[model samples]
Structure formats: structure tokens, C-alpha cells
Target: MDEKKPSRMYFIGKKEDLIQAKRTTVTLDGRDILLLYHQRTFYAMDLQCYHAGSTLETGDMEEINSKLCIVCPKHKYKITLAEGEGLYKATNPTEKVPTPRWYSKGIKQRVHKVTEVDEDIFVSVSTCPVWIESDYYQSEKGRAELKKAQESGDAEADVNADEDV
Candidate 1:
């Protein structure tokens, strides 16, 4: 039998802080990240919006479609909380047709795994979504990189893919 090593966890704050702020910012691994509490659940995500790099900590939070969404201050892009995907398609109401679709879909924010231990909040910074872990390695570039890494047995290439919820 083999035991897996645990991911590095950085202490964010006490559970009380999460309860008080509902949303707060914390610095872990020298990166500023946001900790959000919604519906009695805790979530940690990147501070910057993936769409236009707007500071997500200062963006507006809304509950839509039974999910938590954040409106990017820069372009009003609605990003979901859990998966960090866009809650709505990026469509400009002013134009009959929105700008030519780019990048396939709305930008996805990078999120970290959150855990509660002893009434404290800890997050693993190195882990992120699949796309982000590959550094947004999409299309042909992404496929080639993933294949090469896998053939070479580069474990880090699939780091995020192994994280547990």
C-alpha cells in the first residue's frame, strides 16, 4: 500500500474571519487571493478576474441561478464562484451581435482547494483548475504539451487534475 503526500496548505485566517467578512482577501504563497463564504460554504479563488484582470475582491457579488457569481468591475463579466466559469455568455447588449467570439468562452478564474481545520482556513496555492494548471494551455498547443508531459511521466503536468474536491 502507498500513502500519498498532502498538498502544502497555507493558513489564511480563523474561521471567525470568514464568518465576519463573508468575503475577504488573503495572501498565500505571496499571491493575493480571495476567500468567499456563501451558503455556509467556503471558497478560495484568484483575486484577479480572468477576463480582464480586474481585482475580484472589489467586484460585485450576486447570487444568480442558484449559484454565486461575481461581476468583473472592468467589463461586467459574470463569473461563477465554484468552478470560476462565466455565469452568462459574454454578450454586448448594445450591439446586435456581440464582438466576434474569442477564446471559445468567458475566461475562467483560477481557484484553489479550501479546507477547514480546527476552525481555521487553509488553502493550497499551487493547485488550480485544469486549464490554469496547464497555464491555459489550450487548442493544439495544450494538447501537445499534455501529451509530451504524460509520455515523459511529468506528474506536475496533471497536478490540478488530481486534486480532490
Candidate 2:
């Protein structure tokens, strides 16, 4: 006897709207997501880019080598809409950091589920938390102290007081 596999379902977009357009944006549980229709199949992924948290819904779409591609507006991270690949690349020290390394280190990679029912489409509502290492924790503490000092305006005063009159 074969074991039955668990079925998953998510609501993405109206079938009519998807039929008219290749892509659509839907908000589920306060999380922004994008629905892509290709070859009569649906794919869903987080709207925010892993690189810079830019909304993929507002990003441009292109067809490369017969595959649909989504480009991040903030960093131009190219992702294939068909299989949801290239969404997140591993962090390398050689790569330029747009944001603080600590915050960037906490950016986790994710792949969401996509499903279609009748005329509507849906994506699974789930997010995975990134684990912070010792360096990340220490960096966060330093940043918090710097932020507090800046907010209090004490850091600026100390810097000016050190300058020659």
C-alpha cells in the first residue's frame, strides 16, 4: 500500500486577472507576496528581495532563454520566476555590503509554496528566522549603543568639543 502525501493549498490571485496578466501581487497575513503564471502553472514567492528588501511586485520582468526573470529594483538580483531560483545568493565578504553587515547577515533565504484553485491563486504564509552568530550579536550591541548615543545628540557634541576652538 502507498502512503498518501499531504496536500498543500494557498490562494494567490484571481484566475481571470492572471489570465490577463502574467503576474500579480497579493498580501497574506500582512506579508507581501507575488504570484507568477507561466505555462498555465503558478509560482509564488516573497515580494521582498533578499538582497535589499525591495518589493519584487514592483520589479521588472524579462524573458531570458525562454525563462521568465524577475529583477530586483534595488540591487538588480535576477531571479527566475518559473522555479523561484536565484532569489537569494550566499553572502561573501568580497561582495559589497549595501546595508550593515550585521543586519545583512540576518537576512535568511526562503522559498514559499504556490497553489492555484479555480480562478484564484495563493501562496503559503510562512517565514523562517535567521540564526545570529556571536559576531552578529556583538555587532548588534555595538550598533544599538551607537544609535542611542546619536539619538541623544551626545556623540555629536563630544566630537565638536574635541575639535580645536
Per residue, candidate 2 scores C-alpha lDDT tens digits across 66-104 of 657677665666667655555333445676774322111
For model 1, residues 1-165, the per-residue Cα lDDT tens digits are 012445689887899877888888876755567888877888878776554344666678887666677776656767777777665534566887777432224446767789899999888864432455213332355446556766797622442332221
Spell out the clash pairs found in candidate 2: 10-122, 11-121, 11-122, 12-121, 12-122, 13-121, 15-119
The lDDT values for all models are 0.64, 0.53
**In candidate 1, how many Å is residue 74 off?**
2.3
**Candidate 2 weakest lDDT stretch, 10 residues:** 156-165
After TM-score superposition, the amount by which residue 99's alpha carbon in candidate 2 deviates from its true location, in angstroms, is 31
Candidate 2 lDDT score relative to the true structure: 0.53
Q: Give the top-scoring candidate (TM-score).
A: 1
TM-score of each: 0.62, 0.49
Model 1 worst lDDT window (10 residues): 156-165
Where model 1 places Cα greater than 4 Å from the true spot, the runs are 1-6, 89-107, 126-165
Each prediction's total of clashing residue pairs, residues at least 3 apart in sequence or on different chains, is 0, 7
TM-score of 1: 0.62
